[model samples]
Target chain A: MTSLTQQLVDALGIMVLGMGLVFLFLGILILGVELVARCLSRANEASTPSMSEQPMPALDSRLVAAISSAVHQYRASA
Target chain B: MDGLMAFWAETGIAHFTPGQMLMMAVGGLLLYLAIVRGFEPLLLLPIGFGAVLANIPHAGFTEEGGMLYYAYHVGIETGVFPLLIFMGVGALTDFGALIANPKTLLLGAAAQFGIFATLIGAIALNLVPGFEFSMKDAAAIAIIGGADGPTAIFLASKLAPELLGAIAVAAYSYMALVPIIQPPIMRLLTTQAEREIKMEQLREVSKKEKVIFPLMVLGLTILFLPAATPLVGMFCLGNLMRESGVVDRLSKTAQNELINIVTIFLGLAVGSKLSAAQFLRQETLGILLLGAVAFGIGTATGVLMAKLMCKLSGGKVNPLIGAAGVSAVPMAARVVNKVGLEANQHNYLLMHAMGPNVAGVLGSAVAAGILLAVLG
Candidate 1:
């Protein structure tokens, strides 16, 4: 092939190879991050109980009502 | 009387040529654009002043023994200065936007079409009378499409030293004009709805991921395209210094003192190449035309690619961010945000556009490496 022909061919090859590699490198990066995020979320899940699994302790209704009444009365008086 | 006459004959006015006067005027124009117009003053100021120095009659500024000669030989010819600039750029870059949306790398890669397309355009210009560009010259000229000034200078110095002055000037001029050049193409390609499309907020990238990112990119480049190591390696070194958090001093030095020092030498050396014989040719006009085309094509393609992705992603991606793929750094991103805001008052695309903006840098570097591998 002539030198020009070779250069044209080389340019084509570069376009393909370069673009392919860029996508590949970035693809691998995306996959790696997804995996890391997945693992992190799993670790957190294992360490912490679900909201349904760990409920809050109940309070005395009469004491709660008295406190709410006192706060409301104090604001009204002020 | 004879001694006085001899001294007068030796003065700059005695030996000045029309070409030199024209070039000095051109230099003054560049200075005006830099200082008054605020067009890339950090670079164009030194370059314009150097042009004046180079063109002064009987001055040896560009000759073998001159300061610019040494600066050119030490930095630009050796491809050290541009790499140093890249290192500084890396130090300043935050890849978190890209990391949060790796798919944007494709937009970066897609923008490189401008370089290859302009290569063909450079070669095609040979058909015009008084225009002749070899493959190497075309390669050098085509890199202006990369939209990265230092990369253009580096590749031009290596491939076509004769065209270095025109190529560097064209590259930086277009870079400075990005705000003006990109918006129209971006608006023309995308509809108001596409521009107004809001993207989801990017997830935060972890510090560990940030530290690993540059090393991984460097390793991949070394493995696949060793020719790219010079540019990519220095870039990764600067990035690693920044991301590692252990080398704050080194990163700051690279980003500030080292880069500023090299920019002065690099600008002067590039300006030295702007002497009359090298720049006053049909090829210079061709280079400028081809460079504008390249930038336009890169911007258009990036927007089109984003439109395609927007369709595929069910409109999750805004097409305005595509223009950022031209790699004018935060400037292109800012344009995207501004244009997007014009369409929708509440839509802010700055952070999203940054993903493709930084990706364009890496994309261009890789494209330059590929060209070197093929033609160097």
Candidate 2:
């Protein structure tokens, strides 16, 4: 027969093992949520008509110039 | 003339034992390591000084209730110094990265594999001649792998006080040697491609989340593992002191002056335990050997766990950060960043690794408590 000390040791081992497995599971679970969120957002964008069909909203004049400059640089790089 | 000679003979001390003389030399070596190598001088200097004092021919400082004995009773025996140290650690630690990237908690959990594996190995070592250890002793010895000094002391104090000197010395020594002990294992475990993997930027964690995190951990620890209450309680108190921003003076004291002062006492107390009788035993050598092996395995396990996550996440995670999981704090995290940079200049893993770095401290404390509750 196993001593009480042995039994307690066995029980402690199992509990610690359980805790480790839980953390591993939780990491994967969080990653899954991020992946799902990214996928759903992409799908929503595909279903909608392009926003360019509507007139662009008015922006601060400085902001508009800055946006155009950034676009121009990006296009040159591409 | 005869009376003067008699007085000199009576007042003088005896010649040193071979053991005491050798320990003095060892003490000098530790002093050199601290001063020259810049390895944990805050603790090692005091510990080395204490060893010198204790091993003197007739100091009797380590006698029943001397100052060194009292220091042991007040600081280490009752487990106050370690808790106070934890408080300082909490203040020094920024939980922002950990709270932002909670998934890194797994790396911390995975790192503890070394502790339990060492326990098994230690128990098995008892089968050899000249070494005999109980479960409590094995557990205490195994905690050296956790790489956190206070957690090792807290557990050893409760589980096996006699071995506290050897265990605490081993723990602190290994902690200082982390940059040396860890890198080779890390290199061996990862391929050039894996080492060169560049991870994307981590998301920004809000200040509010960082402020609330210690409170949450403190609450969970109190409810679930009351045995861990002292460690969790003191650490949370330090974190609260730091974040509350109302008591900057006390926070600074805990983080700087108080912890530094207590580190001297803690180190000296630990060093006093290195008498030839206690520390020079065959079991001490076995503990050191097993501790190193356990550390290697823990590092490997943490890396493997990160590789698995990399696979699951389609290689977005950097496996190098996994080495920071063993609770040497920012040092381990900094090493991760340094190694990552060596592989690729642009790859910085510092902030990313801190998530698991701080988490590993908590993981080791919890593991220590579990061992105490079960093994003690």
In terms of lDDT, which candidate is strongest? 1
Count clashing pairs, candidate 1.
0
| Candidate 2: CAPRI quality band | incorrect
Least well predicted 10-residue stretch by lDDT in candidate 2 chain A: A25-34
Q: Interface RMSD values for the candidates, listed in order?
A: 2.6, 6.0
Which candidate comes out best when scored by TM-score? 1
lDDT of 2 at B188: 89
lDDT by residue (tens digit), candidate 1, B99-179: 888888878877878888888777666667787788889888888988999889989988999999999999999999998
Score candidate 2 by lDDT: 0.79
DockQ values per model: 0.22, 0.08
lDDT of 2 by residue, B51-80 (tens): 877787666878887788889988888999
Q: Model 1 residue B376 lDDT? A: 92
What DockQ results for candidate 1?
0.22
Report how far residue B22 has shifted in candidate 1, in Å: 0.7
